[model samples]
Target: MKSKTLLILTGHTKGLGHAILDQFLSLESVQVVALSRSSLDLDLPNVTEFPLDLSDLNALEANLTKFFPKEESFDRYILINNAGWIGEVKQVGKLNPKGIQRVMNLNLLAPMILTDAFV
Candidate 1:
């Protein structure tokens, strides 16, 4: 039997993340765990989808274990932190504070927290 390969991906519902997920799913030995604010439409046997908001730091921290459980089951583990939010395109000085915070939380804080939990 082929060894199990686990892939944890964020922002997997569209764009580049979705493309990467498509490529990974083609390999029969790989199992994909996807996290996105919007649920994915894929119904593949090897895919597990988690609809989540990465901007909520408290919820994300509390649920880290649920996303990354004991690693003993897989022969290899891969984490792809592809989720990001590009805040308003205006100048930094004119940017809204709340928007900046939301972007930072999603693009920076969430990935760091997830990476720490995965490692």
Candidate 2:
């Protein structure tokens, strides 16, 4: 049987993304596209991994073609925007400006960017 849906899941190497990936693995009708900074420890045949640093907006945009090729077609597309980053926990005054930007870029901007590209 052919895959009927394409699932683009971010942050697949850990936490919530990892759990979601495990569940998706059992579904034979869905093809998974996982993006993460590190490769998944499990070598599942149904999943395709795209190693990416989502926090790097420029790089992410530059690599969009490789992840989302225009030639590939799916009956449906599901994007799980699970990628996020919580920078060092401390008093607001102690937070470094660069660190704050990184957190926002990963936790906020990255999702919108990916969604835009997906659409």
Candidate 3:
């Protein structure tokens, strides 16, 4: 039988994202499309790894098109936007603007673009 649900996860190699990926894989009806800045070592049969920086919109869009082509459309798409930062220096003004921008790019902007594309 074919899987109808598609699970898109960020930071798939570690942390909350990895845990979510693990749970998703356990469910029989979902196809896990694990996204990360680098490739994950999970190597599960139901999981397809799409390593991406997410910060790069052009590359992300292109890769999304290639990976999630319309011909293989998912009935239900799950976007787990779990990639984020908790402040670089762990302080208010001490936070690096560049680092903040990187966080925003990965955490917020990438998801928004991918959401628009998914719809």
Candidate 4:
């Protein structure tokens, strides 16, 4: 079997993540696992979509243990944490409590959780 490079990319539906995914697809040796809340609906070879809501800690934690099985060895493991939120553009007091939590969960907590598993 050919050695493969595993790329775990978040926010792959748009922006820099989208651009990166486009580039990675050209390489037959690169295996892409796209993590996004949105449906990727991509019919490309060597690509897998992992639909996840990063804002939900319960769901995020539950999925980590099996996200990348220890049995599988890759030539290289790459994790791109591109998912984030800037939150509402309002005063702190004016912002909804849920929005703050969403920002924290997606921006700060999710990347840490993913990195902890990746490395």
Candidate 5:
């Protein structure tokens, strides 16, 4: 039997992430584990969806184990950190603290945390 390919993808419900997910799903040996704020409306046999809020650091850390189980069934494991947020367009001086915090948490902190866990 051919060894399976495991893909852990984030923000796959729209845009570039969705495009990548489509192409990967076409591969017969690939299985996708997708994490996003909203679940994807895909009907593929090999797709597993996890709805998550990346802005919550504690929740993300707690859930990492669930997404990344210690299993050697797959020949390859890939992680795609595709989720990002752009804060409101404004001068730095005029930026809202809460908005900036939200953007930074999602775009930078979450990816770093996830990468650390993955590595």
Candidate 6:
């Protein structure tokens, strides 16, 4: 069997991410680490789940450091940014600032922070 790899997957609790996780968890070479808004009932053998809110970049970074410290760099690191949201679809003039901000924060900002943390 190939050596195990540390895989970090965001948005893994539903949709495409969920399917990917399902496929990878069966592989002996992959150690899956999933981050989702709520705990999921995935009973894969080599999978670890983290209840996370990706909107909080600082907390995400801190937790990443705690989970994958410098000393644990031997395993491969993979981050999938699949979380996204669509705010009120209205004319520009009628757009809600708060709604747009929340969507951007979750879709764009969180991915950027994850990329930085991975690097």
Q: Which candidate, 1 or 2, would have the higher lDDT against the true structure?
A: 1
Backbone-clash count (model 2): 0
lDDT of 6 by residue, 1-119 (tens): 34557777888888998888888877877777788888797677777788887777667777876545344444566777877767679998998887787788789988898788777
Window of ten residues with lowest summed lDDT in model 1? 63-72
| Candidate 1 per-residue C-alpha lDDT over 7-110 given as tens digits, one digit per residue, 9 for 90 to 100 | 99999999999999989988988888899999877789888888889998888887788775465488899999999988789975798998888999999999
lDDT of 2 at 57: 93
Superposition error at 74 for model 1 (Å): 0.7
Cα lDDT computed for each candidate against the true fold: 0.88, 0.87, 0.76, 0.87, 0.87, 0.76
> Highest lDDT among the candidates is held by which one?
1
* TM values, all candidates: 0.90, 0.89, 0.79, 0.90, 0.89, 0.81
Clashing pairs in 1: none
Candidate 4 whole-model C-alpha lDDT, 0 to 1: 0.87
Q: Of models 2 and 3, which has the larger lDDT?
A: 2
- Candidate 4 per-residue lDDT over residues 1-119, each given as its tens digit: 88789898989998998999999999999888888898679888778887898888889899887667465678998999998879789975798989899999999999999999898
Query: Candidate 1, after superposition: displacement of residue 2 in Å?
Result: 1.7
Model 5: per-residue Cα lDDT over 16-65, one tens digit each: 99998989988989889898999867777888888998988888888988
**Candidate 1 wrongly placed segments (more than 4 Å):** 69-72
List ranges where model 3 is wrong by over 4 Å.
Answer: 1-3, 90-95
Which of the two, 5 or 6, has more lDDT? Answer: 5
For residues 2-112, could you state the per-residue lDDT of candidate 3 as single tens digits?
A: 658977777878888877877787887787777788886666766888878887777887787755645565668887777766546666868788888877787788889
C-alpha displacement of 80 in model 6, angstroms?
Answer: 1.4
lDDT of 5: 0.87
Q: Candidate 2, after superposition: displacement of residue 60 in Å?
A: 0.5
